[model samples]
Target: MHILNIGILAHVDAGKTSLTERLLFETGVIDRLGSVDEGSTQTDSGEIERRRGITIRTAVASFTLGDLRVNLVDTPGHADFVAEVERALGVLDGAVLVLSAVEGVQPHTRVLMKTLRRLRLPTLIFVNKIDRAGARERELLADIRRRLAPSCVPVNTVTGIGGRAAVTRPVGSTQEAAEILAERDDGLLELLVEGGTPSADLVRAALAGQCGDGVTYPVLFGSAITGQGVPELLDGIGTLLPAVSRSALPDEPARGAVFAIERGPSGEKVAYLRLRAGVLRVRETVVFHRGQNATYDGRLTALSVAGAPAQREAVTGDIVRVWGVPEIRVGDHLGGPGPAGQAHFTPPGLETVVRPRVPGQEPRLHAALLALAEQDPLIGTRTLAGGDTSVLLYGEVQKEVIGETLARDFGVEADFEPSRPVYFERPAGTGEAVEEIQRHGRNTFMATVGLRVDPAPPGSGVDYRREVDLGSLPPAFHRAIEDSVHLALREGPHGRPVTDVVVTLTRTGYSAPESVAADFRGRTPVVLARALRRAGTIVYEPCHRFEAEVPLETFGAVTASLAGAGAELRDTRRRDDTWVLAGEIPAAAVHEVELRLPGLSHGEGVWWSEAAGDRAVRQSTATR
Candidate 1:
């Protein structure tokens, strides 16, 4: 059977979870429809998720579509959990971008569509909430074309919109669909220009081909609450999206990625693996590649293919949950390397320290936070100079969720300190340092290390190289030095990660019998730190590119508000009664601006912002 892995994505409160429930009911996967407000949805099983009525994690469910088995991945729509969506995107064959007909295109919706197009994943747009008051069709489509994508074609028509009797009917071969296709196909455009109408079959073939190529997007109208136009949307999913079918050979090696990690009832790690090729069997050992030079091997103690029990083996295109790989992490490649699945989103720019409220539960709180980090790696945790632990966050909601989860799941109450912006240190100049093997008191270890630090272009991260010969020391010793270099750089002189720099091993010396890997690991950091201090470092604060649309009358107030938040305006334009302002702002001030925008414009303001890398901190305002 063909396997189709698709993700349901949208901005928060766009009825993404409700749509998932409706699809399950319409497909006969469930006997009764589950309500999000009633906390009965299958995808949102967590207590906090049910109470909050928001999806905080990606949920997996499957339904059969003819001969194809559809693995539907329902991802969180809230911007705080975008990392979950990013992980889900790596394993999907296609996606459904859901938007509310009332709210139209939102900030997060634009971000998701940009990423989907960047990955070239075939996508279908679902205009949900058609039965709600103030729902729109033609105007919303126009907004989508202007902001999201121009190739979006409505494949269905809505009637009695914005009322209880709202419904949609599938339309055959529309002129807009033909025109959208003609732009991409020269032959088709010539036929249309010559006054010849293409046959319905010809138009469909072109549409399917372009949609599969991720150029043309088909839009469908639906109301998940009332089940209006759901069947038509389901048909669009199976017909317009692509699926993969592969037969794995007996001797072929396994190739897949771990997109998510969950803890079972017994506290054992359960890894969600999407098999791209080859076969995986029970009790078979597999190698997980984390990066270029790190690998971990573990045997599969148990396996379940597509949530089916009694399945001993899994093949290509199957999403299986495997046990016994405790070291496995999200984004780890299983068996052998194929695509690296690079991160599509930025890391959290804000961090806060958390302390156990009861004082004696420090260890428990630390252990629980580590487990949470294992599940969502982007919520990175680190121990501060004090005993408190700090966690990275996208927004305040995630921080709240973490505190609640610790109390509920781990039975540990925690208090979070006010959040602060996470910063980075970049090398300001070139410098070198050397420590001879037991020659000086500073070099206590039996290994000598020499290193140089130089700045690279922004966003290049850390690059490690060797100026010394490969045979200068044993391979294990060299590996130890390289690993130590990366680990030590995690905290620089300013207590921030050092990035955009190159480190070279200038010299190496080790005794044949006395020198060990431990000696190199112990000595490398000291030398590298000295070199970094000599090179000096500059601090940079994360920034975001923002776009704000405000009522024309409130332009002065909005601009003043943005300026007060340290925003640098780039352009300003007038759109009817609204003014659009585009520029960059400090990530630290993003939340403040978002909160004040509505009040500044009397609830007529719209805002959108995305990570725009980092900028050098002004010397006058630099703080640790």
Candidate 2:
């Protein structure tokens, strides 16, 4: 059977898990489909995920789709664990982007659709849960066009209304599919205008062009419940999506990165791998590394796909399980034969941070969190000194999933403290500040620093420059003191990552017959804090870039709201149907606009935001 790796992605509660169950049962892989509410889908194997009716981890299962062998990865739909989605995408040939017919385009929808487009993976939209009331196919379709790039086209239609959409191949040039093609090249447009239709060969060529440039998305309709359109959905997966030639696959070096790692029931460590350009066969010896250049060799004792051990070899585009690999980690790239090109496995952006909620189980909480983090690289969890822990996240739903997983997945209860992100304060135009230090010990390490801090443009990164004489203090004491300065500004006044800022140490004077422990330790914090106060530093604000479309009449309202949120209106343009606005706005003020913009547009709007540089250019949602 031909293998196809596909991802089921969507906004939360949009029936992504339900759709997975539907695919499993209809294919005869399961006796009966399990419900998310009932907490029994194979993909939702973790107790927390099942009880919460949400997906936090990415789970892969295999079953046949008629003539095709599909490895379906049911990804958490919430923005929280976008890491799982991004990690899973590395192994997928294409994706089935699921959506709720009732909800239409949403926040997560905008983000994932953009991601799918960027990766250039051929995508099929499965508008699920059409059987539910108020499931507006026409409205959602319109919104998709309004908010997304024009290449997204509906290839099939849902008949009989209520989400149980019937399938239709396509009729004429009037369909959305035509629009997807027309935007990419004019030859197809000419063919559509020429007569009835272009030859299938011509259309296939056009589709390829569209897919290559992220100019087209094939939209399919189906309902997971009623089993409507499931047949065509199965058939379409084989035909419309062309497989990359087997020979075309690269003969990569023996380098595999761990994207998802787990422990089997017998306490065996299993690493789920996406060969980031590599080769491995049975009994091949490889290194299990511990950070920088430290390692131990181990044979690949086992190999499998979707928990079913395989008889053959693992390849790129195949997600397989490997045994006997130790200290394997996400983002670890293994390549050899000269200087290696390190490939980073940066999963989708995270939006959730969680602290455990179980009683008297803090230590177990760290274990559970680390276990998940090892499996998914995107879940960055760090424990700071003073017993503070930090989790880098993408969104809210992921936060909840992490908490539930602590108690239910690994049997731990955790208490979450207020999250304090690393902060940075950058130069505000060479504003000068002072530092004075004296220790309580017999010899005090006193140093005065005339520092200038200037705000750098966003994304420029933190830069530290020393204007003072490097040899001013005793060699060892001076180095120790500068090190403290670096640590002092980690949590900028704003409580966020400090970026694009420059700190200059213009002057330094120190008295030091310094002792290592008492003198240096006592003076570091005092002088650092005093220096910060003297500079009168301003908080480095977070900036976001967003694309917006609204009725012409509402443009004024949109701009006004942006201004109220400390946004500088940057770009304005007109395209096929609506007006597009792009600009950089303070992240703190964005919550107001996000809540108000949809209301201003009468419930028809799309928004996506990421950290932007000092300068951001916003364009039409369909421009890309």
Best by the TM-score measure: 1
Per-residue error for 247 in candidate 2, Å, reads 6.4
Report the C-alpha lDDT of model 1 over 1-624, residue by residue, as the tens digit. 788899999999999999999999898899898888999998999999999999998889988888888889999988778899989998999999999999899878999999999999999999999999999999999999999999888888899999989988877656677888899999889998998888877877887788899999989998998998888888877888889994687788889989999899999999998998899999889899986657889999998877455768899988999999889888788887646337778778888999999978888999999999999988888887777899998877889999999999999999998777888899999989998889447646999999999999876678899999999999999999999999999988776789989999999999879889999999999999999999998888888778899999999999998999889999999988999999999888988888888889999888878666778887655545
Model 1 accuracy (lDDT, Cα):
0.89
Query: In model 1, which regions exceed 4 Å deviation?
Result: 338-341, 428-433, 438-445, 454-460, 514-519, 533-536, 546-553, 571-582, 594-612, 620-623
Per-residue lDDT, model 2, residue 452, is 63
lDDT per residue (tens digit) for residues 1-624 in model 2 = 456777888988888888888888888889998988899888898777778888877788888655566788889876546666766776777788788777677666777888777777777778876677677766788778777655566656655566334333443454346546766678777766776566656765676556544457666667888776566566556666655422114555565555576679986778776554455677888765443434567687778855345545765455678887766666454453222222222222223234445445556667777887777655667676654456765433455566666666687766554332222345344455554555565745555555566676644555667786777656666655556656666654444333456667676665544345345445554554555445444443335666688877788888888887778877888845667788777544555677898998877766655543332222221111
lDDT per model vs. reference: 0.89, 0.64
The lDDT leader among the candidates is 1
Model 1 sits at a Cα RMSD from the real structure of 2.4
Residue 546's lDDT in candidate 2? 69
Q: Each model's number of backbone clashes?
A: 0, 23
